[model samples]
Target: MSRLIRGVGAVLLAGAVLGGCATHPNSEQALQQAGGDFQKVKEDANVLRFAPKDVIRAGESLARADRLSTYWGSGADVEHYAYLSRRYSAIAREHTEQGLNAERGARLELERQRLQLALRESKLSSVQQQGKWLEEQITSLATQTDRGLVMTLGDVLFDTGDAELKNSANRTVLKIVQFLQLNPKRVVRIEGYADNTGGEQENLRLSRDRAQSVADVLVDLGIDEKRIQVEGYGDQYPVEANASERGRAQNRRVEIVFSDAKGQLGAAR
Candidate 1:
């Protein structure tokens, strides 16, 4: 392809210039003699490419060419391969230098990529280990009976004056989501309780509203409404003494009670 040929020409031209730029002449005469040799060979009829014998000829030509190119602006008539001969030799010298530089760059780039891959693999392994440990913790929590979970929620789920689930109760909400999603056939109950600190009618209304709020959140989190029921346990079924702050806090909470209709998880047959 013409494109490929052009690309090759560009690379060769670059090598010649770069090679000459880096080379230092040991003696002025030696450099001039090499340049003179290239000048004489510029008239040669053969277009020799790079072979072992050709390399020797090219070297001889490059030295002379180098000398002639130095005198280009001195008003000498530009002969047809005079510039060619000089340029070609310079190109040959540049090729050697560029090849060495390219090899060194390739080696360093490969080393950098290897180190980067190693670091990424190490971090990925650590994250996978942490995920496994978290799964184990979830599994342990899943093995507990629903009543134990509800009892736990009673203490830590709400504050003394609030029916809102505490921040510490976030894990419970997540676990409930997981459980409901997994047991798609099971129905759940939301039972809200309030302490006797408020008036009887207000307490009942608050309990019902709070229970409805819990059910609303569950539904928003993808639980099916047909599988859930909400109820208010108003000032009744007290788990602890209403006189104490701790007991009142315990009483003011929501319970996610599982009532399996399909009995899928050993609750049926």
Candidate 2:
């Protein structure tokens, strides 16, 4: 009976040694992996900045695991502490990434708003410059006269004896339209004159048709018809004598007379 008991005791002791051997390698491996994780986080500046407390906790747990590894039959305790250390390191990295992402998002949103503001200011500046240029162009085209500010459209803008305005007049007409749009309170008088080439009644009819055609264009280009007055002087107010073709060309003209800033117009001739 005593011999059989001794044999069983030896077998049990060997089995215990084998179990310890298996657990030791696994615990050592766990401690090494945990140390690697902690070392990486400690070296990262952003991880320390955002998750200092988690980093400290990870270091403390790893130290406890290292101390337990030196003791005999403490494999399970070492593995538990090592696992805790690894978890703390992982938490530190997650927190750091989340913080960095939030900061990046805030910076991007601020930059977007700044760009939008700059774009709007640039557009406003461009519009003001355009308005100033148009004002200068209109001033250059007009002459201050007893008949108020008058801009002349020569006979070259129309066909011979025809009232239709040619496409060559597009630039001048667009300038007038833009000016009227800017000065909404101002009005205009479109006056037509003729040379003495035709009969009295025919000259009067043609002059009136030419004036009405110019007024129609102003209305089509978005100027209110109420702001325009049409008149025909026939051969009465010629700028030059009808002796030569050049003088006749100068006499045949349509003049746009602008009103004052308060919408007051000069008396019609």
Candidate 3:
């Protein structure tokens, strides 16, 4: 009976030792896995830059797990600490990625704001330049009318009894070109008039021909043809009486009328 009791005691001791040996390898594997995870977290640039505190905590936990495993042998304490280290490492990596994404979003928003501001400044500069050019054109044209800025090219612009434009009239035409180029949205109406001295049919034909000549010149100068409207009003809407040579010259003229934003013009007096 004493021998059997001793034999049972020996078997129980061997079983206890084998269980400890198995636990030891599992604890070692957990610790190694934790260390590898922490190593990966440390190598990330975002983690280094943004999560230094979390990284330090993870490293300390892994070190504690290693020390406990070495001194106390594989146990619950070692496994708990290893798990904590891995969890902390994942947290650090996640926080680092979030921080990097936030920084990138902020930079993109700032860039968008800068581009918008630049575009506004450019538009302002363009508006000021257009205003300056328009003012100069209005002054040089020497037009005084209630019909939204009318410019008159006298009979001298065309040869006697002919629709052809004279070379000397190029200066006046170029001024119109400059104005049109600056204000692309602006539209104009060209009205040609003749004196009462000519026959009604002949005067109407000559008037239309002269107006078409002016429109062609503007189109040649890069102005859109669609923006220009032409008409012939024989011996009509004359600015001066056709009783004398000076008055007749003024009556036989082509008047260009600028319109409002909607291309609507006021009646010419």
Best model number under lDDT: 2
**What's each prediction's clash count?**
8, 0, 0
Tens-digit lDDT track of model 3 for 110-142: 999999999999998987797677657765675
- What are the per-residue Cα lDDT tens digits for candidate 1 across 97-174? 565577789999999999999999999787666655644554455434644223134666655446566667667677
In model 1, where is the ten-residue run with the lowest total lDDT?
72-81
Error of 2 at 14 (Å): 16
Q: How far out, in Å, is residue 178 in model 1?
A: 0.6
Once fitted onto the true fold, the runs of candidate 3 whose alpha carbons sit more than 4 angstroms away are: 1-65, 68-98, 167-186, 195-198, 219-226, 235-252
**CA displacement after TM-score superposition, residue 95 of candidate 2 (Å):** 3.9
lDDT of 3 at 141: 78
TM-score of each: 0.42, 0.60, 0.58
Q: lDDT per residue, candidate 2, 1-269, as tens digits?
A: 99999998876566455543344889888998999999999999999999999999999999998887766588898899999999999999999999999999999999999999999999978876887798788779989999889999985776557778778878999999988887788999999887788888887888888889989998999999999999988878888888988888777778999998789999998
Candidate 1 residues lying further than 4 Å off, grouped into runs, are 1-152, 261-269
Cα-based lDDT for every prediction:
0.60, 0.87, 0.81
Q: Return whichever of 2 and 3 wins on TM-score.
A: 2
lDDT of 3 at 232: 90
